[model samples]
Target: MVWRPTLPTKDNNVRLEVRKTYKLYIGGAFPRSESGRSYVVNDAKGKFLANASQASRKDARDAVVAARKAFGGWSGKTAYNRGQVLYRIAEVMEGRHEQFTLEVAASEGLSASKARAVVDASIDRWVWYAGWADKLAQVVGSSNPVAGPYFDFSLPEATGVVAVLAPQDSSLLGLTSVIAPAIVSGNTVVAVSSYERPLPAVTLGEMMATSDLPGGVVNLLTGSASEIGPWLASHLDVNAIDLCGISDAEEARELEALAAENLKRVRRPAAEDWSESPGMSRLTQYLELKTVWHPIGV
Candidate 1:
């Protein structure tokens, strides 16, 4: 009798895990790179992870357009309303705590406990910024005492569109620190996540998509920051840029030069401790101070 190989039984079959497809979060939607490109991401031990989209110049331009389009509505919302929306995002993020913890651990090469702590801090940071959304005007704006018989007041208004290069080292915490402050003041953002550790940022984007935050208010792109940074800096419509993630001095200067074409409010990169108290500087950086003088007897 001829020996025949038996088909594997159902009980002996190995189950395959369902992997996630990481894509760009733009205009409140996930899209594959228009360039049809992706790059491999590996773990700290050089283990195979997942592939992330490689954003192109076109993608950067599209993100700016989305941010510009959303700016009016987001900036028009009452401060109280923006606060509520930001708080809602924190709420949504809390539900995905486990996922964030895992991603943070994998992306940053931290132990589970440490990753949990980082995730916790990231969530709290978001809430902290949310609390300041409505109160910024009182702290930053002022009632001027003028010699003339007129009521003089100063108010903080949102800058149209901001481009952010999220910190490459402190993925989640640093990413949160830069993003929350910008959006809390009604400035829409086009942020580039860290090149090597972008998983946590992508997870954050997923949470934002399901939250009360308006689409385009915070668009996240994952790819080569060096490739996309120049396009964003030079874009005529971008109002401001945070260079906190650019590590090279020469490259930062080059980007700054490009940004000067539009006089974009440039936030030069500085060494930051993400765990430390984040002052009001970032919140006020992208705001425009508008003063109004009302005649005493009009």
Candidate 2:
């Protein structure tokens, strides 16, 4: 075997952008599951940059279990406490705003200004949802009038465990768009981030871990959507699913059927112009109703 150039004879002055590698941020510390599996994350040019875990079905199950276990306290948190915690997430997002802009630009091929807008939209989403934590009842619901002498009032409640298929195409905007709404309404989530752009998701997890979020409120898993989506849909414990950015109608329908097995609540695929101004439609999907009535004698 003959070797050629081992040293730099000429300074080509080549400066290539290197991708920052990451591991699955699970249960707080970044542990690569017992399976010890990883898959490649590529750049916009389709060049392999770093590895993301191929979180197995078992990983999905475990994440569901963690979310379930934490649901009691998280769902039980007072609206004020919940709002405080959710607001803190926006604070962390503010600190990492530039980091998200840079990562989104590289992976999603967005220009600097557009990527910055995307990051801003994501941060603002958190704050928007934060405002709803305590006030959704006043906005989307009201007391009902019965024919009898009784009182009837209806309001939203958390729907146990929600499995979210975070939007696939837009990295920061889509991921935050799905996740913020789910958690802000007091639902726990096991979200699969945009496969092509998971770095921002992992970074978001780190943000939550350090923020005031209680353990296991939001779990982020990175892997094949096709491989993992069905398991979450069919899992008996998963109370609902939101397939916001599925690429095909057939696959979306198939997942919907699986969710129907347990009568899981599903938010239909909508073509809402997420690029437009953000609003309360996302806030309503994750809500459940808790109606109370009392007999009144006049």
Candidate 3:
């Protein structure tokens, strides 16, 4: 039998590199696709990066189950506790900054400098959203002035499970932008990562597990949006859908229709600079406002 020689580097020494396989982040564990299917992931230069799980309808269903089971505990936590947990995510992300920069560079075709900028912004975004958790209600809710002798007030509540389609173009930043807002308000998320660039998202999921985020607080799926988008939109248990990553009008239209079946709160995709200040718009969208009145005669 003929033996094969090891590949040599420029220095003439044999070299081997171990590549990482990307997988679905559900219930705080990385699992292969339930269908046992995977798709090749290529970098900006069209080089093979890794194999990403091709999540199936059953995977989406499982994610919904995880998110629903997590919602009660997550939303029940004190706002201050939630804020601390969100901040821990930022801390973990900070420790993994180099990994994110490299992945963003390969995925987006950005130079090292530009990729670093995006990574920095993404981390800062978590901090921004983390602060909002404890303060959003105070900023958005208000006491109403009524004509009668009654005290009227309005307050916000966390919507149930939210399904997120993360932005496809700006992988890291857009992913962080959409996710932080939804979960900051105490809504658990089942997010679909950037279809074209899912490495950073998978790594972020790993970070989430170690950062004090409970299992199922945030579940991530990587695969064809077209396949999972409709399933998520139509899932009866999902209370909302953020269509931020769906670029095609027809696709968004179809998903919107599916979401309408349950009157789900939908955030339709639109052109915008994700790096800009996100403001409170995203936070408000996932929130449910309840107004109440009490007789003042007592």
Writing each residue's lDDT as its tens digit, candidate 1 over 1-298 gives 9997665678766556789889999999999999999999887777878999989999999999999999999999999999999889889888999999988888889999999999889889989999998999999999999999899999999988999999999989999999999999999999999999989889998989999999999999999889999999999999999999999999999999999998999999999999998998899999999999999975
- lDDT for every model? 0.93, 0.83, 0.93
Worst 10 residues of 2 by lDDT: 5-14
- For model 3, how does the per-residue alpha-carbon lDDT over 209-295 read when each residue is reduced to its tens digit? 899998998999999888899999999999999998899999999999999999999999999799999988899999999899988
Q: What TM-score does candidate 2 get on C-alpha atoms?
A: 0.89
Candidate ordering by TM-score (highest first): 1, 3, 2
On residues 1-298, what C-alpha lDDT tens digit does candidate 2 reach at each position?
A: 8986555346764455676557665555566754788878887888765788877788888889888988899989988789889889999989998888888888898899998998888888788778888897788778999889889888888988999888888777888888878887788999888888888888898888999998788988887778889999999999999987687889999999999999999977777666776677778877788888888996
Give lDDT for model 1: 0.93
TM-score, each model?
0.95, 0.89, 0.93
Better of 2 and 3 by TM-score: 3
Off by over 4 Å in 1: 1-10
> Could you tell me how far off, in angstroms, the CA of residue 259 lies in candidate 1 after the best superposition?
0.6
Better of 1 and 2 by TM-score: 1
